[model samples]
Target: MKKYRKVSREFSKHTINALRYLVKKKIISQMLGVIAVGKESRIFLALSPNGEKLALKIYQIENPSFKQHVRYILGDYRFRKLGSTWWKIVTLWCSKEYRNMVRAYRAGIPIPKPIIFKENILVMEFIGENYTPAPLLKEKLPQNLEKAYDNIIKIIYNLYHKAELIHGDLSEYNILNFNEKLYVIDWSSAVNIYAPNARELLFRDIKNISIFFSKNGVKIKPVESVFREIVGESISQ
Candidate 1:
């Protein structure tokens, strides 16, 4: 129970009810433990009644950085008319992440399959074996550097062209290296390609990936060239 205090403290009445609802609906049999914690959400390792593993991400309504989420939500046409309350904002944020993951999954990108979401809680496929969470790219370096870089690039290209979305924040920290396969996580910051700052965000994402691979001894092309290949245009300096 002590290990769960850190996560339970962040759950509000609404989130508590939402979790209960998940249990009632049999979406999850029981929560196993906290897998990870971020500034805005806590990831819990959970189990299904049928013996399947799942990841539960519950967003904190009182997150200090709640204001930052508005930028991502405002540009998302689906939630354009979102209310201006704290609860409304955070719930919308959770929805945004679920929607983005669905888009990426349908695009054939390597990502956790989104199962369901309600209010501030989201359930998805767990990415690991035997209840152990997979390590981030920053923690576990890929064995095939060249192939890894190429695969990541392909994901980026498909994300933009096929899904019409851009991962606003892409870095080694947000990508998971599971069994030599790359899975991009943390889609809360992703935005539609038509979002106001989409181009800028896309450029930043490309630069981040390019820099990471370069440091890992993979000689990649200039960021600008890769960006051009992705977006099919040159941005004026």
Candidate 2:
């Protein structure tokens, strides 16, 4: 509890307001603890009044390099203009993640289910068991690298073909491995597959996955070949 307060102190009044809104909406009855912290957001483990576990992600807008965050927002048609100030940008960023998760989840892609969003905060289904968050794929290597790699490729294919989206930051760092099932998290960086830079982003995502699995001794296909297969394009070479 003391540690959570110490961390909450870093949040702005805007962030506090968002959390209060979640409680007011009955999305979460109380916050349990900080589950994870990243460069742009801090995730909290919370519970609904009915005892359902939820994950609350609060976006931090006070970062100096917030301008760099615009890259992901500008390309997406859903949020063409990234608001005026850093705070607004961060708020819209929160909403973007929620919407992206909804689209992917609806398409049957394995992603954290978004519950709600207010300002710079987003509530979603917690991805873990017994209040214990799942470890990132980067945190621990899977027992079967081949199976993990195949699952990841299938996820990429579904995200593109079915969801019509490209995970701009797909890598081991953003994927969670629970009971050998892969759940791709962090939809904030995803862009529409039809976006101008979607091809590049898709290629980079495939490259990151291929490199990670190759390093782990998985006999994966070439990145370009994988990209071509996913996008259904003929490779020049």
Candidate 3:
């Protein structure tokens, strides 16, 4: 087995064991390096035994805001009966992201294909080249902003109508722009359409995307109009 990077020591025992399990099962050969870090998780670049690049997202077991994550999981019927233990919650959150990605990918949404998840670690298709991650939409604005804007709107529509989910935390930061193609990421906070605050979350997602494209010189419909068009009801209604 290849030696892990120095940063590997930061992972929890469960995470380390999970990685070992994946290696033993030939799911991934080894982790290359950290690709990105967020408040509650870290994404690592990894390789499969067949030399395929993959993204490994490890949710922090000791994340201080685990309590806050309850809101997203609570209203989603699929996980309603899950336990409240912190580790279990983190694991559930990781599973939520993988399942959300699977739904989006199956719906033909531009997203990383979810391979599998174990404990709090999620392995998925990497969206970059040669161990370099794709630039985020915020980092590298596309030259054709108009087309990008349209693509995002269409993705939002499909996610709602076909996938039956709403990206609760959609923003440029979680979107990748690789070779002028857009792929949504960080789906841990996404919720089903039947969630209590689904409409509010969907509206916020639309508003965030609309504000971004409009400020970047792309003509965009009003946030309310876009929201209503997707949800089939006015925000006020």
Candidate that scores best on TM-score: 3
- Runs of candidate 1 with Cα error greater than 4 angstroms are 1-10
Number of the top-ranking candidate, with lDDT as the measure? 3
Q: Residue-wise lDDT of candidate 2 within 1-237, one digit each (tens)?
A: 244445566678887777667767778677787899999888988888898998988888776656776777776779987688888878888888889999999999988888888998888989899989999999978898898899889999998988899889999999999888889998888899877778888999999999999988899998888888887784342
- Evaluate residue 41 in candidate 3 and report its C-alpha lDDT on the 0 to 100 scale: 87
Q: What is the lDDT of residue 188 in candidate 1?
A: 95
- 9-75: candidate 3 lDDT, tens digit per residue: 8788899889888888899987888889999988998889998999999998988887887888887
Off by over 4 Å in 2: 1-10, 234-237
Write the candidate numbers in order of decreasing lDDT.
Answer: 3, 1, 2
Score candidate 1 by TM-score against the native.
0.94
How does model 2 fare in lDDT?
0.85
Give the TM-scores of the predictions, in the order they appear: 0.94, 0.93, 0.96
- Summarize candidate 1's per-residue lDDT along 52-168 as a digit string, tens digits: 999999888888798876787667787787767899888888988999999999999999999999999999999998989999999999999999999988889999999999999
**Per-residue lDDT of 111 in model 2:** 84
When summed lDDT is taken over every stretch of 10 residues in candidate 3, the lowest stretch is 1-10
